[model samples]
Target: MKKLLLSILSIISLNVFAQPDVKFNITSDWGTGYCANINITPDQGYDDWEMVIKAPGGINSLWGANSVPIGGGEYKITPSPWKIPIATPFEIGFCGGGSSSDIEIISQSFTPTVTEVISEEIWIGENSSAYLNTGKEYYMVGINKDEPEASLHVGTNTSATSTSIVIETEGSDNAEINFQSGTGVSELNFQNGDLSDISSLTFSKNDNGATMSFYDKINSEEVIKVVDGSLYSREVVVQTDAFPDYVFSSDYNLASLSEVEASIDSLGHLPGVPAAEQVEEEGMSLSQITTIQMEKIEELTLYLIQQQKEIEALKKELNNLKK
Candidate 1:
């Protein structure tokens, strides 16, 4: 976040005075909310101080002080009397409602006093975990000199238990992401390549699950890659009862050989084969076309089985006639 300081003027016995230094820092930021700390140091002693700040978003919650909206993105933040000491530094912290690019100190007011000069310093704790709200987005970035490794963890609580999704880079050349729901787990991985160049990862929830997408600077494209079967355990179950026999019946209207030939001639590929024109004109993805092709394969298999049965019956009748 960027900070801007305003010029301050003080009048003492008809003499002009310069204002003290004030600094602001945004300690934590979530998508919709953030926390910030402010420090004020005046050249002279004062009994009470009021600081005005112009923030991008309105203030939602504030602590270590009292504040009231004054209009036009400005808030009058006055520290309690007991909190400030004469000729001492004062600090205050607040959490805001919306995301902002920067915060600026617009103005200040304090009771001036004449006293011996004294140096003072005040420190405020950083709020690192302020951004860790459930169902909110957060990110972490780091660099390691010894070995390259980075990870992101997003967790949300449900009733008494919590669910978390983790994405991390393993060793020098592999990255993996996993989702945990009680005891069940699903993972996707990339092998033999480094993801160190990735600047950030964004995740959003959808009806089915969450979707993660990243931009590839080298390729100059936005890539969304989904990997299935990254982990290795499986079971198989065969359901013979569910097999379809409709392709053997006349009502099925299986595609004729001539129709298939014509399709190949006109489209330069079989029907349901992925084509650039089909995707561009019909707005179907390659994966969707591939699924259609698989269905066609199943239909063709049933037609071939029906033909084989007819051929076997003809041969048996011919043998009977010969005998």
Candidate 2:
């Protein structure tokens, strides 16, 4: 009877030890490198465990465990010396350069031994926060419902209330990229990966969403070059309904052609319909400027049509006189 009871107990232990649950997910991919998160849960409490993975390409870096290559595209990952409770899930992660699709877990081994367990500490609270130091870069990424959300940071650090760039999303359709500072105070400088100078852009936003604006500091030569480089194959149909009634209203001032030419002579550029500087000073947005420019272009087209008609009528009268 005693021998039979011991046999039954051993079989129950073996059954519990055989259950191993592991889940692996690729979190983010940036063409060359990718990040993955994994979770492991064993039915029986274990002092430690080892997981082996095979991938089409080599593993570059791993975190949350000690990993060593055992050759032949296999990496052995051992959890740090700590006991994991039965059926409790623990997470590990790695960032590697590989065929992101061709990763598989080949084997996992668990040692069910009683040992002192050290609890892992997580720093972030319900409201996440990170401390940024000057001259350093930080990247934070996570997966929610099989979608990746990420944020990148690089700049001189200041108080939490000061100017900074923040890009964030809520794992949904909405995303916001903000370059925040006092009104009209901050500028974003762009550069190539080789650190060569590109152009600078500025952004301003007020409490009203309509007041948001973007300004580019490219010189007139660069502007001309950009326009020359553009492709314009599509037919343009200017819809009169798109223009606001204010543009045609009697109260609005339309400068004479000579006045426009004089303004261009003084400013060294074709003046905006209401003066670009004045529009900017009044906090008009780029979209607002574009709308006003389109209206002026359509109005100029009408003036050209009227002049062509007058020229054709005068040519017909001159021919009749010659006849």
How many angstroms is residue 187 displaced in model 1 relative to the true structure, after the best TM-score fit?
86
* Residue pairs that clash (backbone atoms under 3 angstroms), model 2: none
Off by over 4 Å in 2: 1-7, 82-87, 114-323
Best by TM-score: 2
lDDT value for model 1:
0.59
What lDDT is reached at residue 236 by model 1?
A: 29
Q: In candidate 2, what are the lDDT values of residues 1-323, reduced to their tens digit?
A: 11122335455556645646788999998777788988876665565678889865888888778889999888998876543423367788888886778778898887653221111111333345433222226323322212223354344345465544455667675775556675554566676656655675444444432232233344412221112223232333444445555655657666667887898889866666566577658865555666777767766765677689999999999999999
Judged by whole-model lDDT over C-alpha atoms, candidate 2 comes out at 0.61
TM-score of each: 0.29, 0.32
Which digits, one per residue and each the tens of the lDDT, describe model 1 over residues 1-323?
11212232123322213355678888999978888888777776555668888866899888878998999888998877677644566668888877656567788876553221111111222532122212215323223222114344333435465444445655795765345545323334333235445333444455556555554556555555323412122332333432344445578767877888999999887775677776679786444554565567777897688789989999999999999
lDDT of each: 0.59, 0.61
